[model samples]
Target: MDLQQMRYVVAVAETASFTRAAEACHVVQSALSHQVARLEKELGARLFERTSRRVRLTTAGEAFLPAARQALEAAERARAEVAAATGEIRGRLTVGSIPTVAAVDLPSVIRTYRRRYPQVRFSLRAGSSERLVEQVRDGALDAAFLGVQPGFLPQGVRDREIGQGRHVAVMAPDHPLAARHEVDLRLMAGEVFVDFADGSAARAQSDQAFAALGLRREVAFEVSGVELMLRMVRQALGIALLPGAFGAELHGLRCVPITDGPVRVERLVWSRFPPTPAAAAFLALLDV
Candidate 1:
């Protein structure tokens, strides 16, 4: 069987639907099915069990899946290596980010990369740090800027850090303790807290800090994005501890440094997979 057939098998197995796999592969369903059938015939064993509702991998299919994935990755690495050797990098680079990054200083770096590698394409998606880590580990993303607690990242994943920013207390300007230049966790202990959702990287850091101080938070709101959390803070819904990066645009809110709060860290993380030519080129630009 060919690489296309292997790709078809992998896609079909992943999606569990011929139609969905065909759509993902940008091919008609009939052609995809025909190719899979031909592959099975040549192999002398069925790879999938199809029903009206869903498709599943047969035992042989399960056995063959890993090799198929390896073959595809190998082919990808080969293509990337050749492109790098030729000094021409042109491909889609899917990157993920958290909402708070919009407030961080990043425009110049992005603009410089764009100017240097005009041929490289970029696709950015916003998601929770936990989800972004999952995507990077699964090879669905080239890399992502993620908030992670120290020593908490999964095995085989590597990170390039963007400093551990000082944590600050965010709240309405008129809220109690807002007039202070700095606040400690002990002072905010009695107030309602608005925080990142459970299992998020930011939450992990906050939780570790609270646990260290032997304090428990009365989380009034748990949100997915920094914007919503800030909105809540502005309305006096609760106080939140966020990184100083958010200090730039307070809008109707105040961000006071938490003298002893958790350090907020962001990292650019990538999978153990060999980088694509475009991803490598982009990474090279980061060194500047």
Candidate 2:
């Protein structure tokens, strides 16, 4: 019935435990529980089924949650808008990015933004490009940086291509093809490979290239991050195909350009809906 009670409910629903939710909301467990109980009684619905082991939302709670989140967001947006009218920005800026982002230096950008709008808080989420785009569309993230295959655009969101790069073959110093200035994909077909998980956007860059040439390479090691892939290649376990920029600063690894490698297009994506004041400020910093 009240914003405080709704905040308690949303926190509990997200954390799934009164104790943890209270910790997140900076309150004691009993007082948070009292507020939630009072709201449930006023609404004549038991929102959560609480057992010793876990807390689960009931049907009524599931129905109530979306509206509760919207109400909280709206209240925050109103306050942020008022602050913006006074030449100040105040709100949370939630952003998502793929782990291999390189088009823009994220740390530098975040530092600059913080200096400009110290009142705004920030949250960064790392995920696959597909999942990050989905989060932006669903309003779970304010914006995202995605690296996907060329000619592909994330649907249902506003996107701008920021940079483009090609995949290269990365190998140990003594690798068979390491002496070559550039290697043809066909020549490297016989080498073992370490790559991103199968079916991921990063992995697809190599997979699609080999498929186009009627060549198949063995992916002996699958990894979630570029650092791991590089480490595997460094140990001479297998070579990997990654963005050319990724291998420049790595020690003890040689990056050979692939003659016919897949092109990666980096893009910035944001929600189609009107952005919050804080999100707008961040976008303006990026000139998006």
Candidate 3:
């Protein structure tokens, strides 16, 4: 009947065990059971069918689930509204970022964001740009820092390009080309290459560059994360092509210019749901 009881029922249904649900809710099992029973009596319908082996949501419970979650979310927003009215910006903002950006750019930005607005809470999740875009679209995140992949954003999500850095070729220090400050793309012919997967933004751009030069190299490996690919390069698996930020930390690897082709640009992008005031502030910092 109340928010607390509704939360208890939702937790029980999600975990399918009262004991597990109680643990998740940080309450005793008996209290959780009592609250759900009271809620069922108020509704005059069984919310869940509990057998000794398992617990399953009944039709009534399934119908009520979404409304219950929406109610909780609305309550939280109302609380946030009151808090904001008091000049206190306090709420959780979930953000997603690709691994390369997470390692290179996020720490300083996160530190600044927290220092500027100590009352605002942040939950950062790191993943591939493709996966991060999906999270932003589904409203799992308030915003995300994604690599600027073509056709990545869906409607209602806004993406802003902030800054761009150059890409470099990463190779093991013992490699023959390591002594060179720059290597021509034609010199890389017949070499084993490590790069992003096909259809990825970086891969597509690299493909176009290679095509323009009429150069072809054997792909030794394809990976989703630039950081991982760079590490593979360091281990002497193959040479990697990635944003400069990825090679900045490697001591045993050499980053060289890939002459005879277009220079790759690593784009910084941010994707948002309906923008929040706090998120706007963060984006403003990015703009500056």
Candidate with maximal lDDT: 2
| lDDT, residue 202, model 3 | 60
lDDT of each: 0.81, 0.90, 0.73
- Model 3, residue 157: distance off in Å is 1.4
Model 3 over residues 152-216: C-alpha lDDT tens digits? 33454676554445556789989988899887777876679888888875676567667888878
* Candidate 1 clash pair list: none
Model 1 / residue 74 / CA error / Å: 2.4
TM-score of 3: 0.81
RMSD of 1: 3.3
Ranking by lDDT: 2, 1, 3
Candidate scoring better on lDDT of 1 and 3:
1
Candidate that scores best on TM-score: 2
How much is 265 displaced in model 3, in angstroms?
A: 5.6
**Full candidate order by TM-score, most accurate first:** 2, 3, 1
Off by over 4 Å in 2: none
lDDT computed for candidate 1: 0.81
Clashing pairs in 2: none
lDDT for residue 283 in candidate 2, whole number 0-100: 98
